[model samples]
Target: MTAAPAGRPRTARWLLRLHRPALIVWACLVVALAALLLALRGPLTDAAAEGWRQYNACQGRGRCTYDQDAILRYKDFAGYANLALNALPVLVAAWAGAALIGRELESGTARLAWTQSTSPARWLTLRLALPAAAVTVGTGLLCRLHRLAWAAGDGRIDTAKRWYDLLTFNAGGPTVAALALAGLAAGTLAALLLRRTLPALIAGAVATLGIAGAAALLMPRLWPAVTLTSALDEDYPNVDGLVVDQGLVSATGARLPIPDCDTGAGCSAAYDRAVGYFTTYHPVSHYWPLQLTTTALLLAVTGLLAAGSFLALRRLTGPLRTAGAAAGTPSTDTLAGAAA
Candidate 1:
C-alpha cells in the first residue's frame, strides 16, 4: 500500500523526465510571449499612441509629421503576438496527441509503464493531470498578459484591434485558455482512440479547430445582443463592435436584407421600401459575457473529452490487464488481435 503511493509520484516524475524537452519548450514559449506582451503594453503602446496623436494633430496641415515607423512596428508586433496566442490550441493538441500519448502507445512505452507498479489508470491520470496543470498555468498567464497589452492599446492607438475582433477577442480572455484545455483533452482522446502518433496528431489538431469553429458560431448566441436602429443615411450602429445581424428595417418594423447594390440608382430602388437600418450586435459591454460564456462551453467540452479519453484507455487495455500486470504475472494482451 505504501509502495503504491510512492509509485504514483514516480509516475509523475517519470512523465516529466520523458517530456523534459516539451517542458523546456513550453516554458520558453510562455516566458518569451510574456515579455513580448509586456513590451506591447508599455513601450510599443506608448510609441504608437504618441504617433497617432502627432498624426492627428498634423491632419490637414499639408505636411504630416509623426513617428510612422513606431505605429507600423506596433501593428506588426501586435499581429504576431495575437497570431501566436491564437495558435496555442492547435500546437498543444498536436504535441499532446503525438508526443504525450500516441508515441508512447505506438512505441510500446506505455505498455511497459503499465506493467510496472503504477497501474494503467494511474499512469493515464498522471499523464493528464500534470500536463493539464502546466497547460492551464501557461495559458492563463498568457491570456492575462495579452489582455493587458490589448487594453493598453485600446482608445490609444488608432489602428488597435477592437475588443470584438476575433483574434483579439479570444487572445484577450479566458476563452483561449479554455480552448487550449479543450485541445489537450481532444488530443489525449484522439491518441487513445487512434493509438498512432501521426493519425492522432492530425485528428487532435482537426478536432481542436472544429471546437474553435463551433465556439465562434455559438459565441454571438451565448449572450443577448442589443439592437440599434439608424436611418439609412447614418452609419450602422455608429459604433465599432461585433454585429450579429444587420439589415434594413421596413416601415412596418419587419427586418429585411440590406440592398444588394451599393449606393446610387439600384441601391436607391432596393432601399426605397425600407425606412432605416437595424443592427443586432454585441457592444463593448458584452465582451465579458461573451468571453465567459464561450470559456464555460469550451471547458465543458474539455471535461467530456477527458472523460472519453479515460473510458477509451480502459477499453484499449481491458479491465483485468492492469491487475494481471500488477500481480507479477505475464500480462497478455486480451485484444492482441484487435491491436494488430
Candidate 2:
C-alpha cells in the first residue's frame, strides 16, 4: 500500500471531506448570526433608541406615544439572536457526537480506516483537531461580534441586555468559545465511550448543558467580590455591577435578609440604624479576569478529555492488532508497535 501522508494537514483534509455537510451548516449558522448581530447594532438599536427618545420627550404632554412596534421588534429579534448564540455550543456538541465520531464508529468506518493506513492515535487526533479548530474560529468570531454589538447599545438603548445577564455574559466574552471547545471534547468522549450515535448524541448534549450550567453558577465566584456597605435608607451603589449577594448586616455582626421596610416606616428606627445593607459584586472591570479564569478551566477539561480519547482508542485497538497479526495481515497498530 502507498504510504499515507506524514503531516497533519492531509489527515485534516480527510476529516473535513468526511464532514463537509456539517462544515457548511456551521458556516451558514455563523454567517446568519453575525448578520443579525450587525443589524441589531445598527438599525434595530437605532430604532429602539429613537423610540425611547420620543417617549421621554413627550412626557408632561396630554398623551405620550412612540414607535411601540419598533421597540417590540428590536426586543424580539435581540432575544432570538441571543438565544441562538448561547445555544451554538450545544449544537456543536450534538453534531460532534452524532456525526463526527459516533456514526463513524457505529458503522465500522473508523475501524476500517484504522486498519487501512491510519493509526488509531492519528485518526483520533485528526478528529479532535479539525473540529476543535473549526469550533474555536467560529465561536471566537461570534463572541467578538457579540461583544461589539452589545457594547454599541450601551447607554443608547434602554432595552439592551445587561452585562451580567446570563445569555449576554456568556456570549459577549471568551466563555462562548471555551464552552464550544469543551462541547467538542465532551462529545468526542461520549461517542467513544458509548459507540452509538443516538445515545452518544443525547449524552453529549446533556453533558454540555451540565457543564455550561455549572460554569454559569461558578462564574461569579471565580474572582473575589467587592463589598459595598450603605445605610438602609440609601440604595445600594453600583447598580450596574454584577451583584452576587445583597443583604442586611446587623450591628451584632449577623447577616440578615433585608427587612420589608416601607420607606422607613415598617422597621424601627433603632433597627434601621443598626442594620446596614451589604452588597457583594464584581464590577465591570472584573470581566476579563472572570472570562480568562473560566476559559482556562474549560481548556483544561478539553485537554483531559482529549487524552482519555487517545488512551481509550489505544486499548480498543490492541485486541484488533492481535487478531490482524494472527490472520497474517499486518494492522496499522502492529506496524507502529513494531516500529516503536
lDDT for 121 (candidate 1): 80
How well is each residue in 241-321 modelled by candidate 1, as lDDT tens digits? 798998898889999887778558878876888888899988899999999999999999999998899899888877534
Cα lDDT tens digits, model 2, 180-227, are 988888888889888899998998899999989999898899899898
C-alpha RMSD in Å of predicted model 2 compared with the true structure? 4.9
TM per candidate comes to 0.91, 0.86
TM-score, prediction 1: 0.91
Q: Which pairs clash inside model 2? A: none
> For every candidate structure, what is the RMSD over all alpha carbons to the true structure, in angstroms?
2.7, 4.9
**lDDT of all predictions, in order shown?**
0.89, 0.81
Off by over 4 Å in 2: 1-12, 233-238, 252-274, 319-340
Q: Report how far off residue 198 is in candidate 2 (Å).
A: 0.3
Q: By summed lDDT, which 10 consecutive residues of candidate 2 come out lowest?
A: 319-328
